[model samples]
Target: MTTAATDTKATGATGREPWGARAGRLLRAVLSWPNAAALAVAAFVAAPLYWMAATSLKPPEEIGTHPPTAWPENATWANYRDAFTDNHFGTYLLNSVLVSVIATLLVLSLSAFAGYALARLPLRGKAPIMVSLLMISLFPTIALAAPLFLLMRDMGWLNSYQGLILVYTALNVPFAIWILRNFFQSIPKEMEEVAWVDGASPLRTVLSVILPQATPGVFTAAIFTFTACWTEFLIALTLNTADRYRTMPVGLALFGSQFTVPYGTIFAAATVSVLPIALLVLIFRRAVVSGLTAGAVKG
Candidate 1:
């Protein structure tokens, strides 16, 4: 047989591997050790979220079924209605958004300034100060909760939005400052030199020049600070004792009473609570990854 004819016959009429062979190869690659491990990890992480969503849709009676169902047999929106109307979740959601946004803004503003100063300024005790910030950030939140409650009460700020905002900013600032400081240090110094040569003031240079390059770092800090503020239960519970001032986490906890627990409503509220942070992280995911890795190796 001619070489061309033999080649086509050995392969297929198309002169390529047959579809069955390609399918087999693809399956083998998917079931490879690395890909299988990744799938396992993803499923592990996603299992709780899937369960929460499924539970949120389940009917009240089905929530405690003996030998629980993998998927809800009878899904209903009653839980969502209960979450929004019966539980006054809308108010709590609004409070959460208000506190989280304001806290994130304040954190970003303060951290940027502090980070810039630490990264670029010629100052005394910089190392000690950075170390102190790390230590403060690592300090347990439980330890500070009582003291902060007392401080807020003394200032007549308890049960007020400003109380939570201030506390959130303070608790999250040190870590944010650390992230931004590393990112700022990673930025090329020559850029700042050029800005200075052009007679841009320090604040002006940061706003116009350095900040544009540090967008990822800003987003990273914003997401982290916002997530922290959004989910913090201990401080929110301690400070905002008034029902009107309660945030999402505290509100979700109140969905159950001492006599009976409303699993469906609690699950629905939790699902809603996760949405904002999940959306925020999804949108800023690239920036977060870049910001985290960029600071690892200084330019």
Candidate 2:
């Protein structure tokens, strides 16, 4: 017998794993504590979303039954129809889209320059600047609400798209800079040097060479900034209470009257509001993951 076969025989091992052993290994992996915890967390997070969808589909009468139905007994699309037709959902959606897209663009444009500077420039106090940015990002939104509202009012920007757009850009810029800076750091500096030697302007170099390689980071920042602008409630409510300027979250809260809350319609509106962000994350999940992991290692 060959040395490999002799060794295998000596160890009483087959070249292939036994079916029973393979099955047992798989079972253990499936039943691992980490897997169980992950499943539990996923279930916990998904339960409310599932309930919202189910409740939105339930008939009005079935919604208020003493014992709640896990699934809608009498499914209907009436709630969705009412949410769109009876409420200002379309307007709210448009407002959200406008604010989010504008804010995301401004944030990316500004942060791209700032991030590149922080990552590549030989500036003084870069560490302190970065730390300050991180601290600013973590600062409470509620704390800034009063000051920003007053500023907007003084500037006559309240109830205008620019008001929320500016605020969202300012609020998200710090975090975006942080993400993009880290990602930029992960890029090779030699590329920029080569571009410089080839007579490329700094702006041209960034636009053509650096930015392309940093697409993952840009997309990640865009998604985060857009999501924040989309879902933010307090700032939108405080700064823009006008019917035309209200965002989806604010609009959703205004769905029903004080005495009779329309659960199904509210759920329907909520579900609709969630779809854009969900789709965004789903579409760019890979890029987001890559961006987040880009600066985790260094040679």
lDDT (10s digit) by residue, model 2, range 1-299: 69888667554564766677678889898789999899899899889999998999998999989889999888999999998889978899999999999999999999999999999999999999999999999999999999999999999999999999999999999999999999999999999999999999999999999999999999999999998999999999999988988999999998888799999999999998888888988899999999988855521
lDDT of model 1 at residue 282?
87
- The RMSD (Cα, Å) of candidate 1 is 2.5
Number of clashes in every candidate structure?
Answer: 0, 0
Could you give candidate 1's per-residue lDDT for residues 98-197 as a string of tens digits? 9999999999999999999999999999999999999999999899999999999999999999999999999999999999999999888999999999
Q: Which regions of candidate 1 are displaced past 4 Å?
A: 1-22
Best by the lDDT measure: 1
Candidate 2 Cα outliers beyond 4 Å, as residue runs: 1-29, 295-299
- Which residue pairs collide in model 2, if any? none
Clashing pairs in 1: none
